[model samples]
Target: MLYKKECKISSEGFVIPDFDFDSADAVIPISTPSITQYEFDSFQLYLDLLDAMKHDKSSNFYPSILIKALKMFTASIISQKNNIPNELLESYDTPGTLLSLIDPNTDKTVFLEALHAAIAWTGAVKNNSAFSVPEFILFLIETSVYALSDPNFQYDRNIGNSTVALLRNILFHSNDAKFHFINNRGVELFSSLYLEVVGDTLKDYIIIVIINSLDVSPTPPFNFVKFVENPLLKSVFGYNLRSATSLEIRLALAYVKISPECALSFLNHIEIESSGIEFLFASTDTQVLLLELFEFLVTCSNETVVSIAEKKIQWNVFLPHIPMSFDSKLMKKTIQVAVNLFKIGHYKILDTLILKVLLEMMTIGNIKIKHRAMDAIRILINSGSPHSMDSIIGHNIISKICNFLESDRKDIFKFCFEMLLFIIQFALDGKCPRKVRDQLYEAEFEAIMEEVCGCELNEELANMADILKEKFDQLVAESETLEMAELENNHEIIEEEDYDDDEENEFHDNHFDNMNYYQQYAQNCMKGIEEEDESENESDDEEEDEWVDADEFPID
Candidate 1:
């Protein structure tokens, strides 16, 4: 009795030929045992031929000559229904002998023919289930992984990749095979092999195996592919249309889904520099998905998990994708990541670009995105990366945010005042408030703050505004105190405010220290961030230089 053969792994699913020996017709019971034995003796010659060729390939003529003969003769063992594979399996060592021939030194043609025979033996469907022979299946996988691991071993990609597909098929179809695979850290060997192996077929198979394994949390024993595998972080990031399918972006998503901890393990300072940020430049779906992964990593509530994600995923990397998150439609995940970046409080990322997106989001009628955009802007101020709004921090911004102060959207009014306070704070702190002070006066900043003081808003918002209104009056009075005295006292103050000058990152940490609730909202999304960090500290080594080829991308 084979287990459920319907796996939604690929378009053409695998038929798991896991036969139960308890079933009546598990194997054809040969009535004449000696007759079967006599026929089995003949197929032993094929195995012997492989063994002898392995010992001496001096007659290179003969072994190359025997490649087809070996494939046909060995194929007959299962294809002819001669009971040879059955009799051979009864003895433990025989199966290993057939598999042991899969070697780096073996002729590619002869080795593939032997692998074909192994597949037939393992995949033989009617009675003899290949799954029942775990010893042989495991051996074949172990050998194939070794042969494929050889860096110097190069073959025609079609042949090489066909070898990968044939081996992948055995695992593709059987749960028992997959169990042996994951536990043995088959991912470690194969991910390394992926860098060395040629052929889109093999690359495609490995990517599927990885996505299938990491995408879903399998039950015990199969749960963590990370236990031994590297997930080939370096290679996946460096991929181009010339090297692999664009599905690498999907691989990044599956990888992040593993756990925040798992993400940081390979997402090192080095790895992050290589590829994670580039996904924003790919297709829109890819950009949105990549943002979703960043949202998960940055928003995890677990302090340790959050720490790992934040350090590796640099905030400065996301400037390009931020605007798309504020698109006319609700790109909820993209905004979530943008919101997270604000919460993390990196001033390098919270620049004029974000201000533009925020202002645009406010005017759009898309209620869903508008609210999130509002939340993001409020978080940005509350996060205190206010210097970014300095370039255009004047009457236009003051008037726009003040206009929303009347919005009934549950005190989008509260943030309207807060956004104003930040502009005021920058004016005073950057020591260059004349322009902003004038804009606030032009926008009736005092009257608006005075009115907000009377509105039914939260105590924090009210108190924060009350403190700010007084500051606004002082700001206006300071501007008028004496333009000549102000200029004379702080002549260089205006030029000192350039963010790109010598004092760039120098100001970020200082501003973040003032943020009222910088990381407070990130924890709110913790429930959505999955916890698959079963082994956080497992180490992965770097892979060798890539074996390049293959132009096809996987279909969605």
Candidate 2:
């Protein structure tokens, strides 16, 4: 029996000539041994050509011709009614050979064409039962990862696009392939290329690859966070016009969605020394994205997420952006994060500058922010540490709290009153500086409490106000008593100093007198010794005179 088949021209052909294998009149029998031999020989010829191209040291054969040959061979194998025999498939090793040809360092055009050929061959063989080998998938993954790992590799638009397409296709094949790719840290390698590449041509493809990989990854791998937290990605958080694209923001959002804790990782990666937040805020869209991310993190009840958020005490980078943010939702969420942080006892890290910002929020911020600001203040005051109280009082927070008492928002008024009560208690306990207590009294805080008492407040609020007034009165009296006692102690100290000074003067005078007496005694003793020596000299002279006279009288 003779069989005839027509071959459809593949769209993948570029410079390759089209053959009329589909000619209606050219019929070949399926059972013809000679035709089968011819098909095998043709396949072998292409395989031999591939081997030659692989070993070709020089540019003797153009990559275009080689790519066309690859495409034809792949098409032939795919178009055959029957599967390519296992022996032939193994002998050819077309996928492995095509993978080897993908040297990113080669000529850009050649590399791209070779990449396209390899991608096409992989796709063609993916449907072939005989070619469905796990080892082949591994080879594709390893090759793609290796190609992407070349730091010095540069890609033109075509090469970059096609290479990414190739990677994405391989990743889409099966979960096993995707798993292998991620396990090899392929996403990390490709993400690093974002910094290495000159333009945004490959950005979209890279993002898609990352998204797909993460989608297929089981239980969100740790590396997903690592990839998102990569410094290069964080570098984009700055106000660079090039990096403010919606796609990049989406990429960031995707990362955070993978794990809320990743948001903390992202925050950690932000270089505060650089104007990273400012740059991000410069773009309204980027600002919105960041605010959304922050809001998500704050709202997340995950312990790890909350813990990470709490550790970020440095709010300087976020300070400028918060007040300037036009998004009300974003602002509210940001204030909530602050509230949560303060509740966790991060008040010690809150500096004067941040406190001032919070004070502004309480006074002029929207109702939501003002409410949150009140909560934060209450937490700080309730900490009861002298330093915390000092930070509050140092910023003239007492005045800010007083202003809140006049607010129409009952919640604000109630919170303000409670905060005042706490502050007064702190003062009465002497945990605050005496100066702070004095300032509170000078601010006519008692008058504010009386005013609150006159308002139609709820019973709880009214009772709290009355109690606060009573406490204020007692605090003032106690403060006065403490002051009087301090004055008395000062007087006693002065009296003690005066008595000690007099005693010291008397001791010094007595010491001088003793020294003078000792000096006179020594001088008198020396004078006596001198007088004795003079007498002895006189005796000797008399004796010598007598001896001389005797000598004159007797020579014996």
The alpha-carbon RMSD values of the candidates against the true structure, listed in the order shown, are 31.1, 14.4
Model 1, span 250-346: residue lDDT tens: 6666665566555555455225543345644555555565556656665655556566666665544554355545444335655566677676664
- TM for every model, in the order presented, reads 0.41, 0.54
Angstrom error at residue 524, model 2: 7.0
- Clashing pairs for model 1 are 1-20
- Give each model's whole-structure lDDT: 0.54, 0.60
Question: Model 2: which residue pairs collide?
Answer: 2-29, 3-29, 3-30, 239-279
lDDT of 2: 0.60
Q: Model 2 Cα displacement at 209 (Å)?
A: 4.7
Best by lDDT: 2
- Which digits, one per residue and each the tens of the lDDT, describe model 2 over residues 336-451? 65566566654534553566667666666777777777677666666665676677777677776776676677887778778778777877776753665677766766677667
